[model samples]
Target: MAIPAQAPPAEEVVADPVPPPDRRRSILARIWGVYAIRRIVYALSVVWLVTTGTFFMIRAMPGDPVEVLAGKLSMSGLTMDVARVRAEQALAWDPNANIFVQYFEYLGNLLRGDFGMVIGLHNTSVLDHIMKYLPWTLFSVGLGVVVAILLGMGVGMIMAYYRNGLFDHIMSAVASTLSAIPNYLGAMALILIGSTWLGLFDFWDMRGRISIGVEPGFTGEFIGDALYHAILPLITYAFTITGGWMLVMKASTTEVLGEDYVTVARARGLKGRRIGMSYVGRNSILPLIPQVALAIGTLVGGAVIVEKILFYPGIGELLIGSITTRDYPVIQGVVLILTCAVIFTNLLVDLLNSWIDPRIRKEGAST
Candidate 1:
């Protein structure tokens, strides 16, 4: 029995030392790690889907860009054989290539920034056209959405803190009314007020961010002019989107306020301001990130209405114009761009949500 004290029972023996907990990551490091991984995956997936889908879907459309281009070039009068040869040469299209081969070639060219040409747009490269206006659209709508989130979240928090007070009731009524109104209709009314009645805005002079005759480059003057031109449309977008975010924030705050943790914090003799700022604000506001991302993504496309109303030269206008003209390549290209943007935005939201809510990170750790 004393033969080496018999190492006790196996169950009584100390197990291997449990690993120590990881140090809590600095906020910046955690955010960067989540964002970098999310972006890498998002970009790779978007490129894969867009490239393959573009090749096949573009080819599958009822009309051909090459034929459309040739017709616009007045080559419609040529013999069928000549027309066919010309179309092939113009598009560098190969009817006999396998689907995979065509897809690879299309992706290769896209990677090289050769986005082909718009058929009726007089030999303008799709990429070139997009580059010309994408920035304005992103800036206008993107800034508008930021303004919306601020207004919505700020007002909603105020209403939520007030609970059943007059401000809350008023906001509830206003949100209900605005949520039912379509964005285009709201935009139309804003346009009538700002552009027609007040005469504060000029709709016809829209070209680039600045006036039509402004220099064709980015400068402080150009940026200031563009921001000035963007103000009306930005206001319209902010107003239109505010209702949804406000409602979301209000509901989330109300729910979060009722939680036991909040009550416990209050019982700990935490001041109203401390509880509101730390417990209520942190928990309730997380619901807004995804909503903000979605709103931003949606605004990227829906900005067309406001753009048309304000006559701003942006990607939204380009999309509207492309649709009307049935410029398939350009339309498809823009759709692809917007789709990729949305997907990436969504991925970012998911990653951000995980970061903000540690339960998600804990679950990931267990796996």
Candidate 2:
């Protein structure tokens, strides 16, 4: 304290405080930082445009919607004159309302998630109908796709690792053949071979989510019946889906095998299995991740066709009914759901990738 009595001079040449250097961020990093918000905005915009376009397109169609509704009635043997059908349509929504006004109202309802009552089903809530069938779709098609992906990816990796070997060649040929066949064609073959000609799974019910009289529940009878009914449709989606995934995975893995890190791993005296798992397999899978995520939506689209053939009680089946009846509300609701599912899934995949990539994460953290 005594030594400090000589105070430090304050009059020494003062220099201006230097600011930290501005670090440059890469384009990818910038994209990552704003990715979530950007994706959401883009998705919403796409939805809006599509919904608006669909609404207008429906309005612009040559036939009157009321007459279309009446046609459905006629099919049911409940004959209705054009006048009465027009009256009914008027009650459905404001038929007389300005198109723009109707659009705004429609938009408002959509924002509130107010999918109106089903016209064809006579006041059956659209939401209730969707909820009823969506589970079946998820259970059957969703599960089938996931199984395909896992099995396909595994088979593909093995094929890639042992490229040109007997097992690989055999699998490749089988995969190519399966992939070349159309999904519906495969379904037909399965139907004909398994059901019509072979009679292998004759005890397995060919159509519907469950037996006609079986009450749905956790009971063994209901579950067993439901599973039995689901098998045919499950086979159609899973095995057909597997071929495409195998081809993709084989290509991706093959590409990754030639990369520098893989060579280094080999040089470091790593076991073949270890190198494959840690280096090649891990990277080879990255390309497939996006496709797998997108498959959720595509699987639903595929189910629409597959379920029609299988007669599964899924939303695809419901969609077919609504389309035939020209139930505008139901049609709109389903389309909206599909669009949302796809776009949102895309957004999720994009954000997830950013989070998964360490480089992106580090850059984002810096920002």
Candidate 3:
């Protein structure tokens, strides 16, 4: 009724203050925030411990490399004293020096990637030897792992979806059986079945990277021969390795399949295929990524026994040669590389796991 309802009480409109824009963290600080620095420190410590331990352990073995080299030279008709002196000089190391001093000297050279001359390779640089053979392992074993992992993910997804059905049962049995067997056993089996001169198929050569006369280059013909040579060992690795991946994936997928979100996806009218792939498959496969990274790193060492059986010119074979001849520098160099792989892989896995899994990131933040 009142003509002018008493003007609404003068409104006091206080503006809320704007939050200050977040200050950007420095690069190093950002890295530390992500726990990268912590992981790196831990990795470096592990590497140091392993390096020192290996140096001492190898040195502790009775009868030094000099003595072993001398003995070998003696067999080749060199007199004992001459062989001993020659070995000492070729090793370029003083047996009389303190071990701690020698260790520091070795570490220094390692930092420069100078492994010294390899007595096993008749005065070749140990670093040079690694450079030569590392690529072979990288090509064969490394590529095989990639192939196996892809196949594993596919098979695992299918197996999980079929859970307990005919396909799943068959795969589960096969996977369990293969996982229990050592990889080298697969190599041996391939030898028994595929080695042209010795195996059932006798379809391919058991030794050499390419045919004897093929010129070593990027030529198509040479590539074909090398691929032919790699086929059997590659198959052996893939067949045996995929089992573990399949088992892991199946388990992870099964667990994810029962998650509330997965159920929600289905209830929202999503196709079963859509639910499996977009919901369960994506979530389940997250764990495998770290494992795959570790596996790739480990392959740097090459499957030792398998490589031995295959007679593949890989790091494993190089390691064996170094040990047999007591090539101290070469042995240490290979061990150092392997140790780095292990530590680095662990660090990478941790970092990736924390990045990808919110729960892991939360835990890391809390710590």
Candidate 4:
């Protein structure tokens, strides 16, 4: 009993231990892991494949591009000798060089954005023409796509919320009917009604950016005129494409709404708006990311039917004219540009999907 006072029960002392160097090394190893390097390499490989494959495919197409240009020039009353000289100079087509050498030169020119002259259009560089018309196509079709997506998502969400109620049934029927109709067919019908019946838009004598009475420059007047001409085509695209989005989104939303988490959210007595925004919208909208990306590509490339029908000075018309004239330079440029656009769009959607669904990213990392 007397000795117990001396030891004070031999209390244990705890130390604040520091992490080992091996643990720190492990964290650093993970931070700069193989998965990150692999992703970067994968992306670069895709870019290389697209660029090289595009070049080869264009080269493999039938008919000499130089000869095509010369033929087009001759049609415009240029002498054969002069046309051949100009074509050779423009394309650098040496009679002495082999096919591989010619392909390499063409690839170099393409990479430099020198697409040569548009065969049918004198004094117009193919690259310049594409850049000039691309904005109009992008602006008009892009607006239409946005409108379609917004309206589609709203109506689809409402229909899904009601399940098999009257709202759902009505939307399903309308969407089905519209989706069954082709976009071009719908465009033609709208054009007939718009021009013949309602007389809202002018059918003929709608040439250039503005009315002939107004002078053309890069002025607000010209832009306003261009936009005035664009409205019908834009509306046509939206009307034709909306049905597809509505049906797809409606089906997706209904599926998402049936998930267990949605039921749990409901049972928890969460506000309807809160539950919808956080759970329903989040899950249902994942598929829309790819659709939106594809729409972006289509928008930028121009609507072939809508632009052709409306006679809009956009890429679709440019492509059409090139095809008719066998303008190889323009055709190759457009195809390459569009192919790159589509690939990039898909890549962007893939990245977005990984962001939205962490499971995808995790799976990728593991691989």
The candidate that wins on TM-score is 3
lDDT of each: 0.73, 0.78, 0.79, 0.75
lDDT of 4: 0.75
Model 2: lDDT to the true structure: 0.78
In terms of lDDT, which candidate is strongest?
3
Clash pairs for candidate 1: none
| Model 1 score (lDDT) | 0.73
Question: How well is each residue in 75-164 modelled by candidate 3, as lDDT tens digits?
Answer: 999999999988787776777799999989988887886877777457688778887877777678777888888888889888988898
Q: Which portions of model 1 miss their true places by more than 4 Å? A: 1-62, 75-88, 95-104, 107-114, 117-125, 197-200, 205-208, 216-220, 259-275, 304-310, 323-329, 358-367
List, residue by residue over 278-315, the lDDT tens digit for candidate 4: 99998898778777977777556546656787777788
Across 153-266, the per-residue lDDT of candidate 2 in tens digits comes to 999999998999999999999898877876677778888888889888763465888888899899999988887888877788787878888988999999999899898988
**Model 2 worst lDDT run, 10 consecutive residues:** 19-28
Which of candidates 3 and 4 is the stronger one according to lDDT?
3
Clashing pairs in 4: none
Q: Give the Cα-based TM-score of candidate 1 against the true structure.
A: 0.70
Q: List the residue pairs that clash in candidate 3.
A: 196-202
RMSD of each: 9.0, 7.9, 10.2, 9.7
In model 2, which runs have C-alpha deviations exceeding 4 angstroms?
Answer: 1-33, 60-65, 68-90, 120-123, 255-287, 358-367
TM-scores for all candidates: the values are 0.70, 0.77, 0.81, 0.71
